[model samples]
Target: MITLKFKKFNIEAYKPGKSRVKKLRKVIKLSANESALGLSPKVKRLISNKKLILDKYPDGKSKDLRKAISKTYNCNFEKIICGAGSDEVIQMICQLFLNPKDEVVLPEYSFLMYRIYSKVVGAKVVFSKEINFKISIKEILKKVNKKTKIVFIANPNNPTGTYLTKKEVLELRKKLNKNILLVIDDAYAEYMKNSDYSSGLNLFKNKDNVFILRTFSKIFGLASLRVGWGYGSKKIIDRLNLIKPPFNVNRIAQLAAVEALKDKKFVNRSIKHNFFYANKIKKFLEKYNIFSNTVSANFLFLNFEKCRYSSNFFYQKLKSKGIILRSTKDGYHINNRLRLTIGSSKENLKFMNTVKGIFD
Candidate 1:
């Protein structure tokens, strides 16, 4: 047999939140930060009523979806590139920008994809320490050097549920070297209602050094569809297009995402639902001495330091009751904490009831 040899890299694969527990047929999953309201009515109707041409390939450029994004966000049409998910866009950015020995910097407890993709492309991943679970711009700046290629940050940061204000983010850009690329993921931007907050696309629309990633997964309720788009300068978009997989986003996902953008009512309703239940859950958890960050995104970073039980103890208890919450030990390496995704009204009620049963 011919010897099989290929390049190998030391990288830990991503472990998603547990979706099942043994012997549980009906489980309430609050692990993944998915849409609380499920799919938009427009998306559901489009999928059911619109006849699709299965044999033919979708538009490689995703023209209609891009148009919808441009119209919805009021951004330049030529500067957008659609991807299978923001994860794919992150991967492409690593591929396009990184070489062996380059550096990528991000918060230590932020989204795992940024570090994972950077490592896959032979880049050195630098971790910036956060201040009390919030990303520190000073710490990020300390890690930057000539070898740094990109800096990735998720606002209303995943898993932590804490965000930086508009002034703070603007300061970060102003202080950083102009040549370094700052990749901002706005996955939960639609869920934000804070007056001091602003999405990356809105802040960096004209900046060539900044790239913004937007997803239809959170408030738009289209995680299963797997369609996301990136915004950057036209030159960068043109270069990215050269390497983007022809027809990266499938036809069904594209159509669904476009329709999802048009349904502002559904988005607003989801936001309202998230705000109500997030505060409700946060306040309820406090009775048991488990605290969380201020309500910013669609989830809460539940800290068990002052609680009667440990994070793992609560996780196992929930699992036994056919409920699931994200364990910070999975890839985050964070101790004494769990990421609690805001769920539907019924799911949230069940979670609180289960917590009471265990504590009472």
Candidate 2:
């Protein structure tokens, strides 16, 4: 018998939100924070084009997509690096900066990919405490030391809809060690209409130590395409390009992302729709004593502590009705809470009706 030796990691694998229910052929899924409106009409048209060639490999550098992104965001094209998703960008950053025993700091509850990718590179994951489910700059500062290599944050953070103010985020960047890289994920930025908030790309476009991650998944309604891009100093982007997988993004995904960026009308409609529905749902949930954070992102972080029923009870009730929501217990470990993704008009109506039935 031959024995094989390999590196072992104790990291907990990432579990995506549930999408299926037993004994149901179809279900209204509000578990994942996906785009409620689905893909842009332009993208749908592009995908349906019969003239597109599939035999040739996609451009390794994703030049056309980068150009579209540059035009949309008013950023330098040379500084952008495309990826399969922002998840891939996180992994590359970890590989480039983390060494065995190096420390990476992030909020106690954030996008799980930050900690997962950091751990894969043999780095120690240090979680900074969040106050009232909001990322605390002071707590993060307290955790930073000479060993800290990178800090990751998602504005309008995931699982919890709380966000740091623009002033607060700027202050955090200023106070951090100059040598430490700050990676900010702006996955839900398009949905945010808060006056006090700003996307990472807008705030840190010229900063060398700050890298911003943007995705087509959330607001652009291209989750299945797996297209994301990173913006940083040209020096870092040039280096990242070296390790980036050749043809990481498929041809159709690149084309779709480009078309998605060009359709400003669609983006605006989605934003308006998200805000209107999120506010309506938030108020409705409050009547039942199911409190949530202020409206900032596309989803609401529902707290069931003050509600008449337990989170588990509500979850099971909705599941039996073929309505799925993300329970904070699975991986997030946030007891008595749920993360509700704002769905389409039909799906949201179904969810609310199902909840009403449960309560009545």
What is the alpha-carbon lDDT of model 2 when measured against the actual structure? 0.93
Query: How many clashing pairs per prediction, in order?
Result: 0, 0
Pairing residues by index, what is the TM-score of model 1? 0.98
lDDT of each: 0.93, 0.93
Task: Record all residue pairs in model 1 with backbone atoms less than 3 Å apart, i.e. clashing.
Answer: none
> How many angstroms is residue 349 displaced in model 1 relative to the true structure, after the best TM-score fit?
0.5
Model 1 misplaced regions, further than 4 Å: none
Extract clashing residue pairs from model 2.
Answer: none
